[model samples]
Target: MNEDRLQFWSLYATRFAEGFGFITLVTLLPSYINTLDPTGTTILGMTISAGLIVGFYTSGFTLAQTVAIVPLAWAGDRFDKRTVLLAVLAIGIGVYALFPLVDSSASLIAVRALQGVAVTGAGLMTLSLVGEIAAGSTRANHIGKANAASYAASIIGSISAGSLFELFGFGPIFAVIVCLMFVAWLGVFRYLKPDETRIHGFPFSDLALNRRLLTLSSFRFQYAFSVTLVRTWIPIFAGVAAAEGGLAYGGLAVALTVVAEKFTNMCCQPFTGRLSDSYGRAMFVFAGGAAYGFVALLVPFAPTIGAALALPTEIVLVVPSALAGIVLPAWIPLEVIPTQVSMFGEVSPAFLPLVALSGLLGIADSFREPASMALFADEGTDDGGVASSFGIRELVWRPGSVIAPLLGGWLMYEVSMASVFYVGGLFALTGVGTFLVILVWSHGRRALVEW
Candidate 1:
């Protein structure tokens, strides 16, 4: 195979391994916590608290994604992506190894914050490398494949996580992930050779999350915000639909949603990724945004579960993949800007989305993600509060999302499946507006910055 082809596989392997952090939880986390904490225990509440606290803690993780990306990408640009990436894998594996062994809520939260930091490699370095190594023509297709690997990982992660939980317990489940991270690190180190590149210094200092990255990073927050909001309701919506439709899938709606999206995102992202490379990043961003808008419309109006699964195809494929694939490929190049100095590095890693969804994630970490991201934003970044600001928003979603489960199991559970679809669509539509405003406001400055 050609060098590019070889690197593609290497990138895929690393990404596939990295995906375990989030996807496995789709099927494993809730019950896993229940196992450790049991019912009505503080430990279980800690998981919810962890989700909430992690929103804040996740900001720390964003440092790994951006602050590190700035310096590392600079290295790759100046020297070799191989060395930079290998170092990342080592640090990542070491950090991820700590994830499974935490014995208390505080420890687990610390580990999760650390895991959030470690999770940055696949997203920041590996994905950015695809753009660096591939000719522009083929970059998006490669990204799509990367997304596919993630989807595949999500599907497999869920399956494996659930089985590991059943067979071995959380400790072993974490061990499996640790082993996967090790193997992934080794794959990149041994087989993935980086062809030498000669660029001027990746300008670690220049890429500082200064005005430019910060300003543009502000724009990026819109997409993240919208995504967090709409996604928060997905699990609730899906479960409600399953129950209302009288499908056996009711209980596992989140898992099934995760499986569906993982597969579809894997299948479709490459095409979209490629399209963004050729047509311009805005094309895909707007297209995805439009599709998101369309999908939002579907949740509100979907007549049947099958119809919900069909065209305008956003949620039909949205599962656990990259926060609803809300990404507008044009913006991803920011991953390379010296994360610490660049706006993307300094401000964006966690706060970009957290500012929007910290609360949303805390709440939706249970069911949705996009809804969490979309909760709030001002013309500037700090203008908004975490999802906690929209404290009552859950009250709106609870009726359809949280309550339906309680009620469905209790009285008047027989509500139409379409109602959940409609409710989710409303949250999604709110996201659509957030996306459009961001798209319109940040019109000129879509160019990529290098560290």
Candidate 2:
């Protein structure tokens, strides 16, 4: 392979491992909640609820990422992004290795915070590097491919984590994760060249004030709330008990819910990125954001729609097994089909519609993500601090990613689970509206069509 191909593949491998490790944890979250926080944990003087604990656990990682972004991104720009990425990969290996030691909610949260830092660093550096190497016209397509790599990993991670945890336990699952990260580290050390460009000091203050960035931030800030809530809670809703405002699907079924979105997003992004390159990126962004919000709003009604449509009840198939002479009978409840054929269980009526909605979420994001990323890269390259520019993007996302989960958990525990999706959908709608008005007001009406 040539240098450019080697570079992209190395970065892609790193992204895959990052996604693999991250999604492994997400796939295992329901199990963690069931095992570690059956009664909830008391911090300071107050007794926290189970749902609130889930929020805190999930948010802990993002909080650490929020803290680590500035320093990591700054170091990447000022020194070598390749070095930063390597260090982050090493940290990820350590973090996953420690997952086996977690015995309580507190320990799990602590390890997750460390994992968050590793993830943020790897994500920031990889994205910055990809943007740097890609041609201006093809930047979005490259980013889309990179993101598709991550989503593909998410699909594998989700399915494998559930299956492995079911067959063995957390220890073996994380051991595999550690191995993956180590391999990613070795790949980076072997193939990715050191970044030579160096910017002197902090570039965030100026980048933060850039008019285009500011315009983008107006939408991103709100969109963050939408995505953080919807993405995190979808699996939660699928796996938790129906009594707890969930569908009570098995491990593999829950994995499917998570994978559905990722699968569609992975499949669509490359094509979408090329289209965004040809068309106006801003148009794709606005349309995608609006569509995402609309779909999210419909998420709460999935069960209702499924019931009204009166979908089929069950499916059965006979398939060959690993053993040469063995054949297996697989039965799947139509309402909630297990992704794995070995599991026998009935899920709620809402599963298929929810899965459909998840796919729509993927499609909507596929439209927004690459275009949005390319726009950021365009500005970052212009400013000569690509890492810092991406850092600001991460920073802008932090407030929402950090806070939305806590709020979603509270709503799930205190109110209805559907309410979380409703509110998440609202953020997307309002965010797009905010972006549209600002674009017309500041950049002229034709800017929406021509920018």
Candidate 3:
């Protein structure tokens, strides 16, 4: 391969391996927690293992890591991003390998939480590195490409989790992941070098969380609602409902829902994003929200598994839905900073910290996407009401991302998975309503625009 291709692949492979190792376990972590006590959740806590052990434990990762994202990114700007990258990868390796050390549900949860903590370095560094490495004209494409690797990683990990669980069990599987993390760690340590300059001490307080930035972050709330709800609840919802719905391979059916969502997200991203840019964010957001609502509604009523698989066609579109919902709305306030580097550069030193603290909003809420989205829109809020099409993305969705599965687990406990679908559908519709409100808010009168 040529030099550029080699570099891209190197980064992509590292990301993919980390993602594959992490997502596979995360999606399966709740199930693993439950497996420790098949009899019921009493052995673990007041609620299911997912809620008490997994959910609570996992947020430590999200909170610390997400809060660190902008700072980490700022660090990358000033220091050699590669140094930050190597250091974080090393930490991630240590954390992931320890998973096999725990025996009980409690210990397992703790280990998972610590794993989240270790991963933030890897997570933020990786994203910032992508920003540093790719040129402006090609940056979005690179980010999108890297994002696609996340989808592939989730598939590889989740599918492997199923196969590995049936064969060597969770212990062996985690061990394997640890080993893989080490390899990625080595690759990063040896081959990676920081080509980017370090950012000077950037303000973390007022600038990062300024009115313009905060306003931009608020738009993410609706997008987050759509992303988190479906990813977390859809599978359990479908998996549980499938048995009653007379489906074959209930497990497969459940997996299919998730896989379909991701696949739709990846495949539809280019088309949907371009369409959104062409048509405007509002139109796509409305359509995407409506689509999610429609799919979510279908899960409860799935008459058969074969028919059930169809929901991902629209309902489960992960990327498209996010692009539709987030891209236009979230970009509004990003323009306040003008340039990507300046965006962080202009933020007060405390601004980054507060922005990071703002992430706690999502972390505390089971790491739901809405919190992050809301924060993004809010942070991006500005004076000119200018709009731009770029921002940092937090994509270390591993066992560290406990909130979704934990919520999924509780959702499984309280009501039928189908009910969760209904709720998810309701959220989608609500998002659509939010989009409409934005348009009305922007304009004095109500008028509809077509994509």
Write model 3 residue lDDT over 331-386, tens digit each, in one string: 56543432212111121122222222222222222212222222222232221110
Per-residue lDDT tens digits for candidate 2, residues 1-451, read: 8999899999999999999999989888888887785566677999988777788788999999999999998999999999999999999998999999999988988999999999999999999999999998899999999999999999999999888888898899899889889999999999999899999978887798888889989999999999999999898888887788988788888898899999999999989998888887899899999999999999889889889988544423443334323333346333343334534257556778888999999999999999999888889999979999999899999999999999999999899999999999999999999999999998898988776
Error of 2 at 110 (Å): 0.7
Give stretches of model 1 more than 4 Å off: 32-79, 195-219, 229-253, 293-451
How many residue pairs clash in each candidate at the backbone level?
46, 0, 54
CA deviation > 4 Å runs, candidate 3: 1-3, 38-54, 57-71, 190-193, 203-216, 238-254, 270-290, 303-411, 439-451
Candidate 2, 444: how far from true, in Å? 1.4
lDDT of 1 at 370: 20
Candidate closer to the true structure by lDDT (higher is better), 1 or 2: 2
Q: In candidate 1, what are the lDDT values of residues 1-451, reduced to their tens digit?
A: 7865777788888888888765664354344333344222245455333223322222333333333434444454556657766776676677656766666545654555556545654555566555455554564566567667876887787666655665666677667777887888887876777646445633333333234334323333333433433443343343322323422222233454445545555655655555454555533443454455445444433234434344222222223334334543655654443322221111112122212222222222211222122211111112221111121222222223322223222222234434433443344445445444554555443422111
The TM-score of predicted model 3 comes to 0.66
Off by over 4 Å in 2: 38-42, 313-315, 318-344
The ten-residue window of minimal lDDT in model 3 covers 382-391
Comparison by TM-score, 2 against 3, better one? 2
